[model samples]
Target: MQNKYVNKVLKFLKWGAFILIILIAYTIISARITGADPSFMGYQFKNVLSGSMEPTFRTGSVIQIKLTEKEGTEYEPGDIITFQRDGILITHRIIEKIIHGDAVTYRTKGDNNDGPDIDAIPAGAVLGQYTGITIPWIGYPLGFASSKLGALILFLIPGVIFLVFGVHYLRGWRLSRG
Candidate 1:
């Protein structure tokens, strides 16, 4: 009974690892081809590149952003959002909202910063809102795996393991047949 339970647990672990590998491989390939992060179920994953949001979420953490249509979404103060400014993506909390005859802008400030950001961004610049889902410290490994060398190592090790298992299985089958 114990042996059977151990085998079942090992099988479960193997499947879990397989799924994780597939997700990582997909992320790497999609990012390289499209120059954009992949989204799943209306959510996108991004790595925190700075400590601006520390205490809420620290650097080296991976965050989930919930994608929404810009036209219908109404953002307010106290909500954390990810937006683009001068070609850079920034995540910050909305401290104030400015509106002028159908034009809307937001004043954002980082949680760890002393002052608000230098400029107010137009509503069109908003990308998504933070979903409060974070995986701590996994960004380092994910960042590495996105690199060329890291991708090779990521796939190569698993390939070799699968190859060895294939050979072993083939040998066992042949011996049983004989």
Candidate 2:
């Protein structure tokens, strides 16, 4: 009876891990193919690559950004937003809002920085607002997993483990039947 319960628990965990791995793989592949960040349920996950936002969120932390439509979304001075600049995503707090008739721009600054950024970001360049949900220190592993070699190792280790476990289970079953 104990053995049966243990097997059931292990099976449950195995499936859960498999699903998580598939999700991660999909996210990486889709981003590479689309040339844009993938969003799940209106939220995009991004990794912090610098200490600019330190004290608020450290480098190597993963943050969730809530995707919003550019037309209707309202931004203020205190809001932290993610924007694309020269093909790179940057997260910073809005220091000021400049309005020119119907046009709008934002002056942004990192929380730990000494001065605001040199260029004002057009409203259309804004990607999403930071959701304040961070997973500390997970970005390191995530960054690795996105690489070709790292992804191969990630999937290979699990495949080998599952293969070994399957063989062991089959052997035990055959012995019991005999």
Candidate 3:
């Protein structure tokens, strides 16, 4: 009976460790492919930051995203969208969309801001149109988590598990050999 219980525990530990490793690996890779920080974003961010989006989106809120398909999607004058400006992320509503047969340009402004963005939105720069807004503070915590920290956790989790498993497996093998 004791041997059976020990066998079950060993099986559980092995599978659990494998699953954890796979999860961590996927998380890091997916984040990398998306050009986003794994900690706060996954393909898309949940919360919107900055007051520039006010009435449309408040600080500590969330927004949806879709990769710009084939250049840029159709932009309506009032559609909310997120784009990176000089490496900084920003979300604003489009006041006008200029299209000239395969060429698309956008003029954007914040619902609460006094003026429009000094620069025009490059058609190709748009991430996606925000279908809706969400209220969540998830972005703040994600911002705190860094890739380095994720790497540390990825290695640490496996190391700890392997150490524990190694000890347990060795003990089981010893008992069986005896």
Residue-level error in angstroms, candidate 3, position 103: 2.1
Error of 2 at 22 (Å): 2.4
Inter-residue clash pairs, candidate 1: none
lDDT of 3 by residue, 1-178 (tens): 9999999999899798688777767876887799765442324554666778777667776666655566665677988877878887778889988877878888999988999889888878887767674656666654544447856775787789789978998999999999
**Model 1 misplaced stretches (Cα beyond 4 Å):** 1-5
Question: For each candidate, what TM-score against the reference?
Answer: 0.85, 0.84, 0.64
Q: What lDDT score goes with residue 48 in model 2?
A: 98
What's the CA error at residue 138 for candidate 3, in Å? 0.9
Off by over 4 Å in 3: 1-21, 33-43, 133-135, 147-178
TM-score of 1: 0.85
Clashing residue pairs in all predictions, respectively, total 0, 0, 4
lDDT of each: 0.88, 0.90, 0.74
